[model samples]
Target: MSGLGDLVARLLGRSRAPVVVEDPPPTAEQIADAVRDVEARIEGRVPAAVTARVHRITGTVEDMVPRLDRFGVGDRQAYTVVATATSYLPEAVEGYLRLPRDFADRRVVSRGKTSLMLLCDQLDLLAVTLEKISDAVYRADAQALVAHGQFLADTFGQSSLDHPGPGAP
Candidate 1:
């Protein structure tokens, strides 16, 4: 409703609570952009290990964006990619960035690993997982190519010349 309508309603004792409209979840492209933004914001602010892993994750996510349809909506891989960008990656970096650099990088916090080590481990995990997801996304295309090749070979008939004996000259 317009501001005037709201005022009139309030004056007439018909005041209602303001309606809250939630934004829809971001598209795949937006998620990828968010990852890139995270990478940009954290460059040189975090350890080189962290920065490198962030780049790897961002690149993998961008590659997967083109084949997201293979995952369909709400698939776990899709959800993971989105969450890794919007939540997981940012949270890990921010948590590390919030700490004093000396303590984060030197003092062991747990399992004999400093905050930097822990964050690197986490980022490495994220990078590997995203790479796997990207591979799975493209595997569909690879399978299609194989299937088409088989269809062509079968339809055209494979000649003996196509596969000679192991001892043949």
Candidate 2:
């Protein structure tokens, strides 16, 4: 049993630990191009409502790159913060769109919708976070961050407690 557990742990750990490749930080030109590409991709693939939502969230993210300096992200730690905050929304949206409709399995349909709803909620939250950060930087007030954080916490209140039950999904 111990040997089996150790082997399983190593397998899971190895799969999770991706090899690190230190790429250069994105330039203004590269980021602008990337944003354009994402917008174009969204326009072609998703419905108008989803396209609007993606644009709303990603527009704020693009705005953040320039204002990161305005927001005091100009130090050595700037790279880490910027890179960490960069959106991975395009991939998530593409994945969701690609997920097959599975009406046959009633459970799968609900589970799938639950996941999709979470993705949209997450993007909305990301937009709010970026907005709060920009506002905090503009005012040079740490309290704004605290207030937004409180709001986020309140908004997320016991997420598991509110999981879309069956038909609700």
Candidate 3:
């Protein structure tokens, strides 16, 4: 017998046909349901303490970053951090926020808005979820934002770090 036949015979202990099974492709509703499940899991995981920490971190950012008027950010545009948060969250958040509808084709730019929002949203979600899971809360301080910014600058560069001021590259 050929090697292939011999191997098959040995494995099967006789000549048995292999069974095949096919799974149906997921539908759009199924996909949406899965996404909703994931969102619910995330929401359930986040705790009150984590929410507070995230709130504090956001407050810190608000305090450190100049107001849009002070920085001359356009009224037509959303704040960088808010944009970033929206972008960073699942695309669902952006869709929910109706950003495309609101902003139209104005080109908000990733660095200008999406990235910052995403970072803040992700950090806040993680902190909240983890604290909820563990039943423990940890408060973050303004120093944490400074440290995070410094770390980003060190890792990337001053040019890459998102600073809310004119001439910030």
Clashes of 1: 0
> What does the lDDT come to for candidate 2?
0.59
- Tell me the TM-score of model 2: 0.52
lDDT of 2 by residue, 72-156 (tens): 4345333432542344665656566666424221224454655456556666665566566656555655777888888988998
All candidates: CA RMSD (Å): 8.2, 20.1, 21.5
Steric overlap count per candidate: 0, 0, 12
Candidate 1 error regions (>4 Å): 1-23, 155-169
Point to the candidate with the largest TM-score. Answer: 1
User: For candidate 3, what is the lDDT?
Assistant: 0.43
The best-first sequence of candidates by lDDT reads 1, 2, 3
Report the lDDT of model 3 for residue 134: 25
Residue 68 lDDT in candidate 1? 69
Question: Over 4 Å off in model 3, which ranges?
Answer: 1-45, 61-66, 73-79, 89-169
- Record all residue pairs in model 1 with backbone atoms less than 3 Å apart, i.e. clashing: none
Distance from true location, Cα of 44 in model 2, Å:
3.5
Q: Which stretches of candidate 2 lie over 4 Å from their true place?
A: 1-21, 70-87, 101-115, 141-169
The CA lDDT at 106 in model 1 is 97
